[model samples]
Target chain A: MTEQIAWIAVDWGTSNLRAWGIGPAGAVVATAGSDQGMGKLAPQEFPAALMAVANQLALPDEPVDVVICGMAGARQGWLEAPYLEAPTDLIALGQGAVHPNMPDERLRVSILPGVCQREGGENVMRGEETQLLGLAVTAPTYAGLVCMPGTHSKWARLEGTRIAGFSTAMTGELFELLKTHSVLRHSLAGDVNGPERDGGFLAGAQDGLDEPEKLLGQLFEVRASALLSGRTPDWCAGYLSGLLIGTEIAANRNQIGTDPVPLIGSATLCALYARVLAMTGAAGRVVDSTEVVLAGLKAARASIA
Target chain B: MTEQIAWIAVDWGTSNLRAWGIGPAGAVVATAGSDQGMGKLAPQEFPAALMAVANQLALPDEPVDVVICGMAGARQGWLEAPYLEAPTDLIALGQGAVHPNMPDERLRVSILPGVCQREGGENVMRGEETQLLGLAVTAPTYAGLVCMPGTHSKWARLEGTRIAGFSTAMTGELFELLKTHSVLRHSLAGDVNGPERDGGFLAGAQDGLDEPEKLLGQLFEVRASALLSGRTPDWCAGYLSGLLIGTEIAANRNQIGTDPVPLIGSATLCALYARVLAMTGAAGRVVDSTEVVLAGLKAARASIA
Candidate 1:
């Protein structure tokens, strides 16, 4: 039996590609993901990759629209979907979507533009704008702080349906670099993350929040703590994570207003952020990231339609 | 005519081995260096590597006293010279020197133990301890603050001839990691350090000094600023150096005390630091690292004699 498909939603980032097959009522009927992300794909290779996923999930014999977000719209991705200047309404992201020419008659694709900040300090975001759109759709009149934690974590200020300002912290990247490439690697034994309530993690986070400026000095303590006191690798990992996240939250704590900040990311990562937020006397709630992405894509489709 | 090498002072770090042949009066008569750093050598390979350097710089037929510092004394280096816990007397570093076995009768070597802080936040130092010893010898009554900038930058508080407390910052290593491995690499083009008065560098340092916690965010701005404003690679390099050093200084500013902090490093790096210190309302004086190392080794030689 051929399944009826409304459209395809894709989030192509630097290291991974995720595709979702949506039904008529915004239900995800099938999902596919692979390592063939924007970093690995060339402009010409995008269609074949998309086709492979589309063919695997057999659908009705008719033309279907495909809306993509994330790095797929980056300058080096499939095609440049120029960024939509911030202070622009989040729900209206579709207006800035750019359609790329496709050889396949059965596929019609629209790549959504990211958000770019030109003033104050220059900043840019790709797929996160779609997540913001999802938040705007779920709560049309919502306006406050939203934290998206990942490789390049973003803290955004949303006002009603528009994004007022945002800042990106290279927390995840720094962690990876320090763990894999820096001297701190010698001190760590295995996995660095565990439960949110770990004492070491809390202690490290508290220290970071208390003295965010002391980050450079605090990092060396991880190795010393491990060497001098025989600290376990897991504890070291927790401490390092706590320190990074704690510093990030402390740096941006002023942005949190009356509304409880909503965290949009993976469950594990969001839990970490939520815990750190709670420790810092701020309220944070984790929302389902996949659901938000799907909803965001659906909203974008409606605007274009 | 062979030079009269009374002793040898060696600073063997992770990446390079530098050996200075000292005359009777503590002046460097000959110098030799190689890539035989601790990272690349095993215990069995140390003798051959040292012999190669000693043979190149001809001296007396009899064994000469040698004082080794830095990672050469690490557990994984030539042999373990366990850290001397602080508050250790700088003048007594030689008393803790460990002698590694050598088959060659032409060399008598003593490796200096580094300083470590076991409580209140664990910290450790290796080569910098020797430099501190040199500072003690050069300025007997000097007691206040000292900043040694490098891969693992150290900031120490000195009281009389003892090291009261010290902290290490991963400023240099972090800068290298981000510039070579992170996304910011694309924005950078050439060398990382430039002139002192470079406007971009100064501004970045000022920003970092003002808000050290915002480092993670400010790093991203470098990329965005480059893409949006076409910032040159030299400017980016200076800005990055400024940011890291600035953050480090701001974090450790309380340790500066009443006297001008003395910077113990290479001339170029010390100049950069001196500029930053002046910017932060603190005076910094540059001291020759080699001279300090020779002075330190000579002092250690006296104690062991």
Candidate 2:
């Protein structure tokens, strides 16, 4: 049964490593993940980490072609896979993949290159490029705005198979920093649930969309609201989340059109972005991130083959 | 010489405390400070902390009035000195001062109340209100916008002696959090100085003032600039500082008039604000925080007398 293992697909990022074992028909047979992300590994240690994850699948005697994407190919990662400058052809992403020198004979590893926009204020994306590639492969004729929400949320303008341009927002990172480290942490002490959370989120999103410029001034209101109006910690947390997400959407509002934007990310995050998008009289639909990354990996594998 | 001590003025904040002993003519005769801030002490323990700082002055046998401001007057501090709702009369700020019962007979402590805005938006200021009062006392007829930059930078609109309205921006706190804890920390590793620092700061300030609404999208550019262009850590730090400050100023730009804005706080911080304000085609003058606070305490003392 293990002999049916055709090749491997991996999405190795800064904080986590996810690998999928695909069969001959381009379907996932086995899947594995670990906390051994690029941030925690030295260049030499990457081989062992990859092997450990692959060993769980019980590979055959023959070597397996492993198509890897993300920070694993960063300058500080296993081997530097230099970025492909935008506007890059998503289908041709595999043309820039770099083969890292792996000691294990069974692992034929090719790390995909990220996309960099050097001309327009210097922006780069590693794993998201593959996901964008996956989006391109999944919907061959798709074109418009695609939103991928995460620690560094990216919004890309896709024209056919080409990524014309894109921008990254530190919304998720800022929200986490404010929640865990800032003075607002004292006010946002509890977890929120139910209608209270929903109402707070919508109210905050409205404020953010209405006056994104006044975000700095309004942030202190979280503390002030807690102190003076007795707003609960749950409300504060929901409001902060909505405010950041809303502001992120508002910043990119000009690019958004009448068509439903395809949000490719984790279900939870995409749902939040979708809700915020709806408030702007725009629509969004969540596309499974794992599915697209796998499709993207498969496309890269086919290109290399 | 110690016998000439008339009263004491103290600014007890979240992380630090400072006390000044006044002589017969209302001049600073002695000064002392400690890390025993209101945040560190229990309500009962506040008396001991105050005594420790006052003991440095070798107080006379007679009872001494201790005038306090800042977080020491908050509901969570030594005693809950209720906030005086805005539009508050700056000269009459002392009318809301609360006295916590002291164990030592010689300590006659009066904690000044903070000002709160409940109508337009939830906003509050503690120690800065006293600085506003000090500004009022020093320039009795002067009326304009006063900026106090700190952990929570404040902007107050002064209509003669009355505070018409004000707003708070979490600019300083955001800068610290992003520099120390966010992903930007990796790119901003070293201290910057001289022309490069100034240049980076001005460039970032200009961008921030020009398009404050796009701040969320622009934050990631810091990291991108470092990765693509090999920008120095000094440049990154200076740029981040300027960007946040500039955005803060831009948010409050409508309130700023042709008059030179008065910046009150630590010299270094106020200087940064002044530079950013200048970038907006407005002038700023740094006011000595200590002198103004002393004058504000003196004004409060006069009110009590």
Candidate 3:
């Protein structure tokens, strides 16, 4: 007999959506995804978008539990899911999940709420909370600083499964803007390989780590170095990347302890962050973002069950 | 008789070109400007673009001296006027001026050289050098820090008529990019006036000044503040402006001594910088940029007279 599907898990972000059908034993039985992300769909369109992915899986006769995460629960998304305040336990995430009104009787849907910090400074995260929950499930005793590198990189302090506080740095976004739109665009062309790339990266990283306060002043040097000294575009690009990442690390240096920080993100980006962290006399380990998010969804499913 | 144009002064920048016809008494006899800046013209096209403005003034039978400054001297501009290393006397700027081949015998164009600093870091200034020279000509005893706020805000250390060194911050450019392209774009809207605008600006300025190192981390707070606490777009815009200006001031705090900084730029921008400078316990006085550029051009003309 074919393995009976237990439930459905969906990670609906701004640009894309991914869904998985889990079997009774918590193993993925089927997988599907679409470009129909939260950004594209209206409140009424969300049901159809989800069904497009869900229809791929073999649905049982009865209505199956469907847990959704990310921007799908935002105020502008399918249904508004109010944020749970920070210092919230990972285990308690499922209890806060809000049920969106489902049109089809075959689907029982619940969207997980995001987390927000209000005391120190205003901050919010929709999708990352689930990943943090997954991290907790995968490693029950792990607790310290966690760095999730992306466009808006987040650095969170965790106490066991609870997120104490977190801050975001717009490093990746700024790098993209500077590379594509700013005056440094021309200076940041071409590609370099091997030791030269490493050298350039290290030099810029060192500058950023040592004197982040001088960042605004140092940015023009990229263009000047190219114009005056004819520095290659590849070196400039590498240097810019290292500078932004290094500055991000330096900004959060106060929270990073001697313990090895778990960097959760794509391998390439996490690797860059790890290298910069090592340069600052700190250790970092890569944690696959996909694995954690899935584990977090599973944990949430179990909480509701 | 019609006032014979003694010479012409042109500030050919990236986006716009402005020309003035000087009388023998050193007063402006005629003025003209166009969108045909250095960025749009080719090597051969420079003559016609210059004439567009020059033709407006009364011309004599002989070729008239046309002293040009700004990006017109850039490598990509009409003619490449090599940068004179910093600490060179401002009065000697005319000596380094290069003359591009002119098709019109009625115009003898000389583009003034910009200043470059290579000892500490790579830095080059084109048009602003003329203004600095103008400042030197107007106030011969002035020797201190000069702040010029624009798209690329410049802070230079001056000794008499010499520019000792200078650094640039892309504060204004970054602000525009963030407001138009970043996620915070939605949050930074509305028209704030009076005390509300000042309050927002001061609050953001204080944060930026107090914790410049955390700038990267603090940027997302703009979006968060709007998302969580419902900040008005006007306030957000004002805050962003304050934050950037404050951060710029903080970075250059070392160069800013007890001496009052002479801010050279548009009156509106200079006022903002002056306010931020005051907040840092430093004083700033506005100097009209146009007056200085004209004076500097006149000085260059006199040197070659």
Best by DockQ: 1
Report the C-alpha lDDT of model 3 over B149-202, residue by residue, as the tens digit: 988999998888888899999898998899988887888765655346677788
Local distance difference test, each candidate: 0.86, 0.88, 0.88
Higher-ranked by DockQ: 2 or 3: 2
Tens digit of per-residue lDDT, candidate 2, span B1-305: 35478999999999999999999988899999999998899999999999999999889899999999999988889998889888879788888889899999898999998999999888998888888889888888767899999889899999777898899999999989999999999888876564567777887888789888888887899899899988888888888888888899999888889989999988999998898888778989999999989989888866763
Pairs clashing in candidate 3? A134-A296, B189-B233
Give the Cα error of residue A282 in candidate 2, in Å. Answer: 0.7
Badly placed stretches (over 4 Å) of model 2 are none
**Which parts of model 3 have CA positions greater than 4 angstroms off?**
A191-196, B190-195
| TM-score-best of 1 and 3 | 3
Q: What DockQ would candidate 2 receive versus the native complex?
A: 0.80
Interface Cα RMSD of candidate 1:
0.8
Q: lDDT by residue for model 1 over A1-305, one digit each (tens)?
A: 65578889988888888888888877888888888889999999988888877776665678999999999898889999988888788778888888888898799999999999998678999999998988888887778889999889999988767999899999999988987898888876575554432777888889889988899999999998877787877788778888999999999998787677899988988998988899878888898888888889888877874
How far residue A181's Cα lies from its native spot in candidate 1, in Å, is: 0.7
Model 1 regions lying over 4 Å from their true place: A191-197, B189-197
- lDDT by residue for model 1 over B185-242, one digit each (tens)? 9878665444532877798899889889899899999888887677777788778889
- What's the lDDT for candidate 1? 0.86
